[model samples]
Target: GAIVWVHASQPVQLGSGEALEQRYDRRPGGPRIHSFQVDGGPNRLIEALDKLPGVIAVPRLGTVEEDLAALVRRLTSGDPAPAVVRVRQGAGGAERSSEDRTAPHLARLWALQQTQELRAKRQVRDAVELAGRFQLVTPVSGAVVLENQQQYDAAGLTPVDPQTVPSIPEPGTWALLLLGGAMLWFGRRRRPR
Candidate 1:
């Protein structure tokens, strides 16, 4: 028996009632899509879906705006489209209520890094980070928040890798003095004729 490794999304499931669900496993950079049939208990599907990048349950299709719907469709479809999409928090010029506040700066920075840097570099870690950040900002639920936090921890994305020097040692530029000293000592070198 050989161990096979694969980068795949949770299986797509056609569940009973409103539970019927599909997973869109986005390729890092290319326009590739994979879907699998989700089996087992609802808990399994729920858990799997929770880990997907930008996996919003879309509780109400009727309420979702047209642009957002299209965006979702494009993201989930198997077309020659960008695998990762930079989703603005209030995209489609949708208005946000006072209750729905924006995420913290660190969260926003993480999102930017995930989508712009890591995603551009085609790193799977980016997706994991993106998903975790999305879950945090979105009103997902206590259970999902806990589950995503676990995922982030597993991926080494949690705690945000502390800095060796938490605060700036000095305000002035160390480089300026060092370089100036070097220039004064060495002076100008004569070019060979």
Candidate 2:
């Protein structure tokens, strides 16, 4: 049997902040229509994310860690208001928006994904390191054998000599033994009894 530990987070206040989500709709021959769905109230940051001029205008951190940290800070900011935002795309590509803002739910989801990614990388690194230390066979670790005695000598490594061991007799040998035993039994029966 094994023990397990589980932790549950506090429930998010449903009416406190607006739930923000983006949707893209494409009809059979219609232009792609992009829209945002807000639950509670209008959010300035959400608007800014949507109408920001170009990709350069949208704000971003240098690294995923930095982005996650920023999201954490926002969630802990203590303002109990719902916000909505959209990402604006420009002709060239996804244009930058004025602010580097993200929906809390979206940010939370992204952070969770990033955490999993980091964990997987760490596990792989640890596994590789362990395999290297113990000389264990893994995807990135393998064994190489010297081709012959000369190769072993050149590398200053002694090769274990092959050992001689007894093995089972062939089928013909078994047949010959059975034949001899039958003949001996028959001869004894005729001469003595």
Candidate 3:
């Protein structure tokens, strides 16, 4: 519904884990903080998180850092918290062989799980609303009603007349027309010149 702000980290080579403490805002306005010792690849993690509702383009900090920083700073001065990604590089960081291999996979799985959870939650919400309350037209729902002119005028809507409404001829009507045409042709052929 609104512009999405994404903050990402510089490219860090894999195998650098167990020595770094990555701390950042889960979301600018989010309630909790995230601290991780493993490098889940900030760019990759952000990419995975992009499936969430209202998320837009995933910005690459290394390439568009200055431009994005300027635009964001000018547009929003922390009015609504942007997604802040905090990644701290530590000394002797490239050590944990196992974490390095698993972090990316874990991060991707986390993103997919979050996406599915959100979708499921949305479906539940829609089902509850549709089942319990009066229905209204929405992007995700629709209805049809054949209203009279008076009813259409009351609702401030235009009603289509039955004559203008599209419909197919009945099978009997088609058969009768075909037989009439064939009889006419036969009569014309049999007539004397």
| Best candidate, lDDT | 3
Give one digit per residue, the lDDT tens place, for model 2 in 91-183. 567664646565444544443333333333545465555444343444434455788888988988765444311245989999999999999
Per-residue lDDT tens digits of candidate 3, residues 12-125? 445532222121112333222121212225554434433343334433444455645654574456454465443323348644453344343344444344433434355645
Model 1: residues with Cα > 4 Å off, grouped in runs: 1-44, 54-56, 61-121, 124-193
Better of 2 and 3 by lDDT: 3
lDDT of 1 by residue, 94-154 (tens): 7545465554554555564455444335464655557464443321222222246678787
Whole-model Cα lDDT of every candidate shown, in order: 0.42, 0.41, 0.45
lDDT of 2 at 141: 44
Worst 10 residues of 3 by lDDT: 17-26
Pairs that collide, model 3: none
TM-score of candidate 3 to 2 decimals: 0.21
TM per candidate comes to 0.22, 0.16, 0.21
User: CA shift at 88, candidate 1, in angstroms?
Assistant: 9.9
